[model samples]
Target: MPISDVSSLLPLLVAIPLTGAIFSVLINSKHGQVLTGLLAALSLALVICAILLGLPSEGLQSTTAFRYPLAGWEAPLGIALSLDGFSALLLTLTTFLVTVLTFYSAYYFSASPARVRFWPLWWLLVAGINALFLSADVFNVYVTLEIIGLAAVALVALSGNKAGLTAALRYLLVGLLGSLCYLMAVALLYHLYGTLDFAQLAAKAESNPLSWAALALITVGLVLKTALVPLHFWLPHAHGSAPAPVSAILSALVVKASFYLLVRFWMEILAPAVTNDALMLLGILGGLAILWGGIQALRATRLKLMVAYSTVAQIGYLFLLFPLLMSAEGTSASQLAAQHQSALAAVCYFIVAHACAKAAMFIAAGNIIHSLGHDDIAKLQGMAKYMPLSLFTFAIAGGSLIGLPPSAGFIAKWLLLNVAIDTGQWWWVVIILTGGLLAALAIFRVLDLAFIKPEQASEQVAPDNWQKVPVAMPLSGLALALCTMALGFNADLIIDLITIGGGE
Candidate 1:
């Protein structure tokens, strides 16, 4: 692969879609919607090509920074677009999932009235995600993050119900609060470090109150955004009440934006100064999120809401990588750094697995709701008989969620577990396995609905437009699930990417 652009292609990934956001506004109403989807698809395709055009190893290859010096300035003064292995993985997922999400929304809302407003907001969201993944500058990251919040709000509002409106409002309030905290943290960093770019801050930062405060503020704000445990009150209602595809994005990627920010901050901005105590705190929270999310998901009345709760649980798993990454018990610094890359890579892998699996589950639940006129798990019977594709998709995604063998989920869990044990963090191992077990419980609850005979005879199934759902959507989920399982065979390539990734 060759370099993508001589001067700058990195910013183009973000600018092109953002430009589409403006251009999409000029489109005639219905035409605008079509154009928006096309633009999103095109932008994503270009990003994939550009990403592929980077330095490669295998499995999780990434094209590093496509440096475009803003106004032809140098590194410290100009903004750049850096696409490391992790970012590339996420960028690809973001685009691909957004495309699927748009298509899914088309049929999901086809008979519904909200169909008219869904596409534009959905496209802007794709744009936001692209920008968020590609952004390198702290201030620029904030701009993109705000766009995500706004677009999500609009998407939520498209549901056009009282519950939707109320949920959107709650999301808005928390979103702004998180943004403010992040902004204040950014301000603190700029005040202390005098540079908003990650590389510069990294070089300048030392152990100090300002740095700790800024990092704490940023981490807490992001935790709020990711809706981790105590700060996650806004998520269930917002994701549960939104349209199906919207819920998929909310569960799959929206919350992940915050997680991405934290990872960037950790890996690029503050690797050394962050203490073991902080990592421990994150692990503890991760454990709670896992347990609480699983229990709540199992208890949810609505299937969509149950998936939302599962997301909460999935987030807990993400944080367990921290302590494992921070260890130097046996390994030297260089090896630990290399291991850090792999751990971070595992996070990315987990993200992709979760996104595909969760998307399928949401779509499956939507199918059930569409056919049955409700999503209550208790009411579902003979779903597998009626909707095999959807059920199979659900099962595949569930397999990934539970860390079952041969799936990408298992590979990710296996790698992280090894890191934990090597570092003498047995607690993390216990927590992860417990989380997996709880995930098993939640997944089986839904599957149980389909297998068990109805207590009393149930009414005949209603006519369903499930045929309208694209074969591509569920198949895409299945492919991801299967790929995850297959990932176990390709650990070497994944580890290679991670080895080079931290440097990229």
Candidate 2:
């Protein structure tokens, strides 16, 4: 395919999964699983092709943004889908993770009847994620956000137990509340600007009360959806109670869909209206989320809950980008631009790292539950002896979460620290380091119990009673965990891609 034609393929990223979802509803259970898996794999391939074709030829100065107008109509009249460096990277990440999890889900749900409802909901969630990343208008973003939240809620309810149903209900309420706030912001922005296009809004937005109101509404809505700190009460319960694959999708991509929008709103569309005090306040909230989430993770009694709380903490790191981009009064324009690019790159790296590591950890936790029929932290004693692969997967992913050397998490934090220091924001450095230590403590708490001697284990399961975990489960998780480590070594490609379109 020619580079220029890549833009035309953008809609396929959304179409394939949506078609699969509709087809899944019509098919029988066995065929639906097979069809879902094949369509997901195809979506991953399409994303890769689009990304390759979309990249600027070698020796080019920057990336070209690909825009596809629906039915050949331009923005402000018809929907426009765009693929820039930021959106392209996220599209690839979303598809890659979805493909791997689809494989895991196939095996994970082989014996369960929930497989029927799972395939369609899973595909709908994938469609929502792809659409949200590609959407170039605020109204479309809100539409996609609603799709993602609804699909995710239905998926969480698939467990069909009281806890799962209750968690799903709470997730539904939280999602509805967040969407209401976001829709209000969208309406306010439209009323103020008379357009929904991102670029148009950015160009027209001013430092006025209405713009500030829109920004505030956007922040509250996205913050609640992203589950950052005080508004994060809904996440742990929803993510921990859902099935493992559902939990992986929620923590890995669903929350990220909202955060991605928040980044776009604060850093791009509403940049003119962003205030220094607001930036610093977001940073402070991020810092608090880091500390509070880590402490809660340490106290979590269940394996899945611990990983879910860790997600809350990792999200905090991304918010620090807001304040880090608040240039000092005397900084040169060139220097400020450089700092902005660096901060964007760092947060992007953190998002990718957390998605991979957290997904792997959740899958590993699912494997443990499958093998031993429970996920109680105390009862996980000596798990390493029998379930070495899953335990190893968990530990390696935990290492990344702790920002250990040679892990993608470390590279992301290193970039963030460099930006903080370069921008003379030294206080964030202290918070970053403290958060790492707290993460290490929480991770080690799990590792310590898992690696205990079998004979000395207080609640070791009998050998004969251990259920056999399918090979695909642990292998799939290990693959994602290794991707996190691999990213640590080869960040230049991602950084270069991220810098395309000038890191906007």
User: Residue-wise lDDT of candidate 1 within 1-504, one digit each (tens)?
Assistant: 545452255666666666666665666466566666666677767767665556455432223344455667655677766766666667767777776666666556656757566665776777788778877689988998899999998888787889989999999999899999999999998998788887677778887888889889999889999999988899988998888889888888989888988987876687656887898788889889999999999889888888999999999988887776676656777887667766776777778778877887887777666666677777666567666777777887899899987877888888778777767778888888988998899888878777554432145343352343556555545554565566667766555544444553
TM-scores, all models, native as reference: 0.91, 0.97
- The most accurate candidate by TM-score is 2
lDDT of 2 by residue, 43-145 (tens): 6676666666657754233333578889999879989988777877788888889889988888898899898889889999998999999999999999999
* TM-score of structure candidate 2: 0.97
Deviation in Å, model 2, residue 160 alpha carbon: 1.2
lDDT of each: 0.76, 0.88
- Candidate RMSDs in Å, in order, are 2.9, 1.6
Lowest lDDT block of 10, candidate 1: 58-67
TM-score of 1: 0.91
